[model samples]
Target: MSDIRPKYKGSLLRPMKALSFLFREPATLPMEPREASEVYRGFHLNDWEKCIGCGTCGEICDNFAIRMVEIPDLPSDPAKGVKARRPAIDYGRCCWCALCVDICPTGSLSMSREYIHVSRDLDSYLILPDEAGMHGENFLKGWAKSETSDLLDLARQAMGELEPEARSDNFDEVTKGFDAQSALLEASRCIQCGMCHEACPAHMHAPEYIRAIWDGDMERAVEEIYRTNPFPQVCGRICTHRCESACSIGRRGDPVAIRWLKRFAMDQVEPQKVQEIALKNKVSKPTGKKVAVIGAGPAGLTAAFDLAKLGHSVCVYEARPEPGGMMRYGIPEYRLPYDRLDADI
Candidate 1:
């Protein structure tokens, strides 16, 4: 053996060098709760107002720890794409993968910095999070949806349009309808947040119908659209599309082509079948109450349709000789053909 022990050179000073650190301030951290990093994923904190109760988080939860429970007090407007439900998390099974945070349509769900929880009660781990933290301490946000981790398709599928030369020569439909694949792809982009419902004056069931279209259930989609909107054909073509303006996906990307989806649904169903679906819920018995609508525009017609369904007699008075006020007269022929407008009415 080569005398390895003899190779130590000035090693006696190494032990003394360690003592120098002893005189320096000792590394210490306060036991008190400290703020986590800005992007740290901790406990969930949901904004109930912004949450649409779409239950998408539960679906994406690979651990199956999330469940959508109906909170009856919360608004459950199907027409608006809101369910009377919220996510109840079982933390015992949570991996904190943050999938829910990234996929949230409205970005209402986020994680908080404060994550401490110690209790004998097992139920405490099962929480329905709100704006407050796990203990209502209102901890500052940690992890939240960001551009980097966004799961929604931000870019809209470009709809094809006829060239100006091709369109101007004849008053043909300007935008060619979305093919089956295009419609399905567009429908898949919806996160079902229901912001469109809130923004729509007609409160159309955009999410439900959009999902129906994606699921390949055209008739079901037609039915869902008819729930709130009686003139899908006309609205699909020429409505100002306030719903698209409020779409949650629109915040980060092109709002779901909601108007186009509606158009696609209306186009799939035959005029006769659509007429049958629209009148499916009409009351069989006469209510003896009569309603007089001033115009045949979308607003007045929508009200008349509902009233008629509730067993009330509706009499619509249109100033124009043709019933469709703006849809028939105001909108250009290429945008909404007279035949399509007739089919809608």
Candidate 2:
């Protein structure tokens, strides 16, 4: 065996010496720009026709280069989960991470292969994207969000429920609502897209309340719930969450359990506290106007709740003996517990 190791060698040469040739112009090419490949991530090109103006691009921007500016002339349909707002990008501050493109629910935001630009004013760097490219030319598309690079928790957390054998003889709530930890985990799955708000019949603030639940602020969640929904408990149990259908995450995986999260938040808050929160916005002075609401269902009751709060005398009529028309008579006790439903009313 050799007892001695080879002697080490060291060099004093500078690492930049290898790059000295790169500084020299070895090849000649035209100064005119050329088009890039379909995958090239150059400038932004938005399709106004399909854009919903959700401002999700701004929300997901890590550099804060995008801002949602209100354009009055543009369509603002909150019912469809769109706003009259458009994204104004600051090229000077933009990192071009493409997170905005990835987070866009409508798939309207996309990048163009055109990279060349000439501007005299600094304000020109700040631009509002539209169907046309920056120069109003239809440039080829570049980097875009695909299913391969999605950044959302699409898989929903499984919710517990009573089995048929478990509740066969007894009449009890079928669904076992999320616990504290499970509720927080479920709430964290939300991307705050606000699609749920538009798809909901009452335009409930689902994202806000979901975030509140994630932050462990049940009171805040309940307050946000009261912003639109007068019957949180009832809706949590039986309302057909159309928001889930419109969820951006559902494109790939299961949609977030928005309805279950609502139930969890409402369950956390005391019944008295919920009532107090619901009545907090009640009208102090009654108005002379009178409104008659026929049927004590959710629709009529919601109308009455709004009208009554506006200082108007509102009367609600229902065919059933109880106020909760279909919600009470139609829905079974197993599906929607009567105690929770009564608490909501």
Candidate 3:
């Protein structure tokens, strides 16, 4: 390497010439509005046909901006998971996080490219979005599900079960039910929107019970189930679960196996264990009130149970030889066993 002294060979004249172009031309953005990138969060677009009016969006709404409104002309059927009630959003409280869209069971709810909304009247702020755009201009979809970004797990875990080969020969139950790890994984997927509870015929405390199951507390889940339904085994297996239909997670993916989960929790512990846990919250002193219950079906028996638990002497008169009314006679023996029904009684 040779040591060299630098000489001032630099020229300022060449750079001064380049600066003259700045005065000649002004900086400008592209004349046409640029299209938003894919998956860009923007305006609202709700597919009314797909929306079942489950009101799940209203429940998960932290802002209480969403309300369930009854539409008289709309169809309502619990079995198919359709409801007459749709959501009316109050933009004043809506944060536009699009959680409602993410949790929508039907994937009918979405945002659009038309982001601007101007209203002189405050009532216009609270509008129910239909197929038409906000300004009646059908803008293309903006925010939508991408391969990389989805709030839900579309695939449900394959529950452990005795395969058809194994179960074909045996009288034993086919499902093994969820293990501790599997139960926790399944429970973690819930958003706690209470759509399951609303959809349940018995209106079981699904969210609370599911939370308990998630926390690995079978006792708590049993207690919660017993609040609405005394026979967890019966409901766990045979009850038509409308809850799964309204499940927000079901929109993009498989709904949580709420019925199976209830069964899993109930089956983990013995019947005696569940009884003991359930009785912990029982009232010690009697109200000394006597009540006559006409039937012993789920409805009558449930009422009787409540009355009996309240310290009222409840005498149930059944027209049939045994209790459990239709549950015993109507439901198949393989589904809800007589032993489980007897345990609840």
Best of the candidates, lDDT = 1
Put the candidates in lDDT order, highest first.
1, 2, 3
Tens-digit lDDT track of model 2 for 83-167: 6777999999888788888777667788888787777989988999876778888877898778876566666788888888999
Better of 1 and 2 by TM-score: 2
Which regions of candidate 2 fall more than 4 Å away from where they truly are? 1-41, 45-52, 62-64, 67-88, 106-114, 121-143, 146-149, 284-295, 303-321
Off by over 4 Å in 1: 1-93, 105-150, 287-295, 311-319
lDDT tens digits, residues 129-194, model 1? 999889998888999998899788878888989999898678898988799999988988988766
lDDT for 252 in candidate 1 is: 51
Screening candidate 2 with a backbone cut-off below 3 angstroms (N, C-alpha, C), the clashing residue pairs are 287-311, 295-317
Put down candidate 3 lDDT per residue, 1-345, tens digits, no spaces.
Answer: 976988766887977878789778777876565676666566667787888887777777899988988989988776455778778888888887888777666777777776666679899788787667576677788776555445666677678767788757655655677888888888888878677777787788999989999888888899888888877888888768889887767866789889888988888878789878766666889888899989889889888877777778889999999999999888765467678778767
The top-ranked prediction according to TM-score is 3
Residue 326 of model 3: what lDDT? Answer: 93
**What does the lDDT come to for candidate 1?**
0.85
Q: Could you give the candidate ranking by TM-score, starting with the highest? A: 3, 2, 1
